[model samples]
Target: MEFTVKNVEETMAIAYKLGKFANSGDIICLNGDLGTGKTHFVKGLAKGLEIKEHITSPTFNIVNEYDGRIKLYHFDVYRVNDPDEIEAIGFDEYIFGEGVTVIEWSNYIKELIPKEHISVEIIKIPNKNLNYRKIILNYFGEKYNYIKEIFI
Candidate 1:
């Protein structure tokens, strides 16, 4: 589904709505450029998952783990040179484990993306006044078809 948000709050709200369905083993891919509100969206997602602590981008650490109503494995591959780099920190186990995973800058390691994951692409529209964003959400595989239908 495609949505246009006039401000950051709306973007977060949308993310929060979808996040209500976040469950164990759910993988979400977030694609966006710098300052496009990707991290903000994830923060809202963490809120939806009932996480109490503040959420920040896991840029330096590569991954951040949080305990909530469900586990959240948040990753930032911006500095990753290779997908294998994550193996040292248990990439497969986290993605396939009992937690919700969100990956930022995922295009760098697209090969690792599962066929059943949810993808969110945020694009900034260049307009002097609005700082608008176009958020596109796409879900792959049968497991996500239900989610797709609901979002549409």
Candidate 2:
């Protein structure tokens, strides 16, 4: 779906909607440019998941874990040079674990991601000061059909 968010609040609202439908073991791959409100969306997601802590980009830390209605594993691979680096950190544990994984810059480690996952792409339009994000929900396997249904 394509959405035009005028500011941060609208972006967060979108995240909240997605978060409400999220389930454990679900993987969300977020693709966007700098300052495109990916973190803003994450904050709303955390809130919707009933998490009370702060949500920030894990760019330096690589990953951040949060406890909510379910576990949330947030990964930022901006600093990762090789997909092997993700493996070194034992990414599979988070990716395949009983938690919701939201990955930033996930394109970097696409090979490691499971086929059945959700992909959200956020694109920033240069004009009009509006944050135009194109969120594409792609489900690869039968296990994710429910997710696709919810979004539809």
Instruction: Choose the strongest candidate by lDDT.
Output: 1
lDDT of 2 by residue, 104-148 (tens): 988988898888888877777677765565555465677767765
Q: Largest TM-score belongs to which candidate?
A: 1
CA lDDT, every prediction?
0.90, 0.83
Per-candidate TM vs. native? 0.96, 0.90
Which RMSD does model 1 reach against the true structure? 1.1
Clashes of 2: 0
**Candidate 2 deviation (Cα RMSD):** 1.7
lDDT of 1 by residue, 1-152 (tens): 89999998999998887777787999999999999999999988888888888999999999999888888999999999988897778899999999999999999999988888999999999998888999999888777766765576
Worst 10 residues of 1 by lDDT: 143-152
